[model samples]
Target: MPALGIDIGGSSIKLALIDHHAPITIAASDHYNQPSPDQLTAHLARAATRLPIPPDITAIGICLPGIMAPDGIRIERSVNLPALQGTNLPDLIAHVTTSPAPRRIFTDAHAAAFGYWSEHPLPDRLFALSLGTGVGACVLDNGQQLLVTARSSGHFGQIDVGPCDDPQPIGPDGGHNSLEAYIGLPALHARYGSALAGHLTTLTAADPPLRALVRALRIAHAIYRPQHIALLGGLGLQLAPHRDAIKAAVDEHLTCIADPAWSLHTAESSHHAAIGAARLASA
Candidate 1:
């Protein structure tokens, strides 16, 4: 039987059905952009009902970009989608699905990393960085996710290396190039809006986002010592053309280790999180 996986993020929602049998395959899939919780829930219900083999959906997995209550039913805080805060996602989902399939939930980063791990079972310790509305990461050791409870995720976006004089506010600010500001759409737009088409024509070593990304990768390599580091999400994939450039930047900055052990790869699957959800549910 296949299990259903749903991934809710800051800007998009995606769902897929995965058969965790001999050859894992996606049986069905769908996506929506920036839908409210109620609208998104109804769409999922409808999508599940219309599946070619609806009965094949024996279990369901949900991944969200926020904190969940201990009971696992309520979303205590949806960081990007504020409306989902203090709402019970599963109960809302149950209101729509006909069979009320057994369900599992995961954080977005954790789910994406898990999905990648399922597809490529190479290195035991891996780090997955999800970059879009925000940058986040998840660490997996021997296929097991760590820091997955309510507020324990590896929020790498907030990681600061500077020595501050006083407590500085963290978030989007145009003065300095924070990781999120450079990668997030709003900041990127604000910085390059005047020359949107002009800037993209020639992305070089000067791009702050690209530089910050390289720095982040070096830091990750030092800390996690992961065998592989996978990058996913809208903006993350957009940076694919500059993969070689990013590598060069890393080499220039890395002092202690000439070449890091981890191999960097861009995650290409649109159904990654959903696939991960289904895999976990089947397990």
Candidate 2:
């Protein structure tokens, strides 16, 4: 049976029907700009009514950019979407579905990592960085997520990568010299005004985000020694065309423990989190 996946981000919300059988496939999908909490609740209600399959029979997976309670029922904090803070996302989704369909929640980064890992299983150890409104990271070892509880996979965005005196921007988390401060949407917007999308392709190893990303990838390699490192999310996928350059930059000054065959990759689609959410629920 196909499961439903919902990914709520700082600027958008997406839904997908995922058939994760022998050959995974997305049967259907939808998206909308982020809206008020009440509007989102109404939208889910309408979506439930219009779904091609009954909610009662479908498993639902939801992911959000925030810190969740240990049981995965409530949001402890949401830096991007303050309106969702303290909200019981699972209950809200269930209220709209009004059915017995099992539901699960995940941190957006972890979901994206699992989604990417599902497609590329050869790499026993996979590390993924999600760059969007905020930055998130996750690691999958042999298809099992590590250090994940309460929807936490460790805050990769908060790691200080810049000099203390560097007067660059900071993300919502207010972690000075943090990775997110260097590459998050707000920082990129500050660096490249309205032409951000066009500018992603032109970024080089010496550029702001890429430079910071290389530093972060080096840190990831030293710690995790992942066989594959995936760049994912809204902004991450933009680096797809320049993968070779980014990989070369990371390969420079490489860590001794890093995998010799470690490779860089991008998610096949921006909807990976939503699809991953469904995959998580099914599991």
Candidate 3:
């Protein structure tokens, strides 16, 4: 049987058909950028119709960008794509497909963690951090139990570091301190008073503060105390420029273990949510 994975994000949706028999052969792949909820549904339906082995697909997995409770009904607070709030995504997709294949919806971070764990299956405990417009985290225990949190449990960006007040401002003067304040793309641009893209390029080449920012993330591992940590997403991968610095920082902050091996895995595709969704379906 094959599995269909779909990752829904603020800007794009990614789809893939994976053959369980031959996991290496991704039968079909597609993506749609910035489509409305209804449009996205329609596109997925069309994709389903065109899949090479539609009847063989055992399940469909969807990685959503908001809070999804265990009931699979209520969607809470999708900051990037607000339209998803309160939307029952499983029903919507089922209605669109009109197919009996099972479906599963997972938080984007959880899905990424699943994808990572599927590859590296031995860790007794693992923490996954996704860095992009914001930070998302997921934790796995004994390679089975997924610790889902209502609050920003793995939201690395929400961690407070310095005295710059809150990174995001609410109402008027109420600010909140989060890692996003210093490391987010927008904050970085604002701090430099320049375009984020240009600043990112320059930072990649040589920026002492940026290097320190990378080190700070590694230091976070000490507080969490997971057996291993995996970094995901584009921004997380970019931190590789300062990997040695980060390792040094981690060693300096950590006391429990002499030297911990923190594994870094870049997102295999921009559509990780979609890939994760498909994996969910297969599972």
Model 1 clash pairs? none
Select the stronger candidate by TM-score from 2 and 3. 2
Candidates in order have lDDT scores of 0.67, 0.77, 0.58
TM-score of every model versus the real structure: 0.80, 0.87, 0.73
Candidate 3 local lDDT, residue 196: 58
lDDT of 3 by residue, 82-135 (tens): 667777866556633555788877667777777767766746777777665456
Model 2: lowest-lDDT 10 consecutive positions = 22-31
lDDT of 2 at 42: 62
lDDT of 1 by residue, 1-283 (tens): 7777777666656667667454444432244545676776666566555544355478888887777878877788765666577888756566435556788777777778788788787556787888866677888887887674454446677665322212322444232335665555544566688785466546775666566677777787777667777787766566667777776776775756433555677777766887888788878
Off by over 4 Å in 1: 21-39, 42-53, 148-153, 161-178, 193-202, 255-259
> Which of candidates 1 and 3 is the stronger one according to TM-score?
1
Deviation of model 3 at 106, angstroms: 1.4
Over 4 Å off, model 2: 20-35, 42-51, 69-72, 94-96, 148-151, 164-166
Candidate 2 collision pairs: none
Best candidate, TM-score? 2
Per-prediction backbone clash count:
0, 0, 10
Q: CA shift at 79, candidate 1, in angstroms?
A: 1.9
Total colliding residue pairs, candidate 1: 0
Give the least accurate 10-residue stretch of model 3, judged by summed lDDT: 166-175
